[model samples]
Target: MHDPFVPHEMADEAGVHPVTLADLVAQSDIILPHAPATSDAPLMDAGCLATLKRGAVLINAARGALVDGRLPGAGLDVFRQEPPDPSNPLLGMANVFLSDRTAWYP
Candidate 1:
């Protein structure tokens, strides 16, 4: 069985993208982006967010630089800015959860 805590590669043997970042953003109800933070482009942010599945949950545990937006009820161990400003909107939301970056270590 696949390791439950880690994300496996999304390509198949033929090098086809069975599950792409684009695919995840557009279709998934729960998106855990474990992909690299590339300089290629920012995530297709607003356009994709608008089309996200209802009740979508985006946990940006890895690809922080690639995404920027407000998401509901996020349990975040990572953020685009470490120690985000007090004025950040998520900080005021009742459902959002933020953790210090050390929460993952033993």
Candidate 2:
């Protein structure tokens, strides 16, 4: 619950205690990165992923991720490399789910 756009008062009223981004990711069972990503840094990297609680799930709304190693499960809507290479480990994980950013035709 760390949205800078979210007024402190609104968050408090909703019983959401906004915490430091690192702390939120480290503590949450389910993490949803609620911000947009920049070209300078990925929303989540291997280092950040390593800090997460074991068995934690990462849900990437649109932010890209560069991850290597294990995850209990991951739901990613974006990747550091679109249509990631066949050798990418995340692609081989049974617990990881990935989707394209594009909307489907009717």
Candidate 3:
């Protein structure tokens, strides 16, 4: 649980050990970007993905724009464009796993 916007007290109440974004990416074996995608800025872009430890896996149940195709491997459920274009780099990567957005719907 690494969210700078979350107050320390709230984090404590939630029983999550909050850390800085940099630390989270550097230390995590699996990164899950759960933040909402209302902001113009992407939470995780190519530069941020490059900082991830080698062999680290990214699981994006949030917005697809949060991830860059440069990653070695990823599990993606959403994309900037639903049913991404056939030429999307991520769709061609052998290590990338893509699931339909509705896979999670109940």
Candidate 4:
């Protein structure tokens, strides 16, 4: 499946063009639906990491395992484990931006 991470492009453009990982790596920032894997003990496997754009900002407000496996510099509001294990690599990544999941609601 080809998924383009372009900002103004439609989903069809991405899905139809077949953007490879190399293409994405050439760009900056990626917005994902979940967090990277290998966090917490029972690490979930997520393949979206294959689509990650190098130096991209993964936006995960959906599932913690959506972007698992590959390390990303992202804005994470959630994780596979609530109150993510302190040792998660993302915590040490200089580009990561984190927020408590509950901060989004009343």
Q: Pick by TM-score: which candidate is best?
A: 3
Give the per-residue lDDT of model 1 (tens digit) for 17-72.
Answer: 45555565677777666656567565647666777787887777785566765554
**TM values, all candidates:** 0.64, 0.62, 0.78, 0.46
Model 3, runs deviating above 4 Å: 13-16, 102-106
Candidate 4 lDDT (Cα, 0 to 1): 0.57
After superposition, the stretches of candidate 2 with alpha carbons farther than 4 Å from their true spots are 5-10, 65-75, 85-97, 100-106
lDDT, candidate 2, equals 0.71
Off by over 4 Å in 1: 1-20
- Give residue 61's lDDT in candidate 2 (0 to 100): 68
Candidate 3, residues 19-85: lDDT per residue as tens digits? 8787888899987788788776788877787788988877888786666547656677788888899
Cα error of candidate 3 at position 55, Å: 1.7
> How does each model score on lDDT?
0.64, 0.71, 0.79, 0.57
On the 0 to 100 scale, the lDDT of residue 7 in model 4 is 45
Query: How much is 5 displaced in model 2, in angstroms?
Result: 4.1
Give per-residue CA lDDT, model 4, range 37-95, as digits (tens).
43453222345456555556655577665445656456788677778999987788887
User: What's the TM for model 2?
Assistant: 0.62
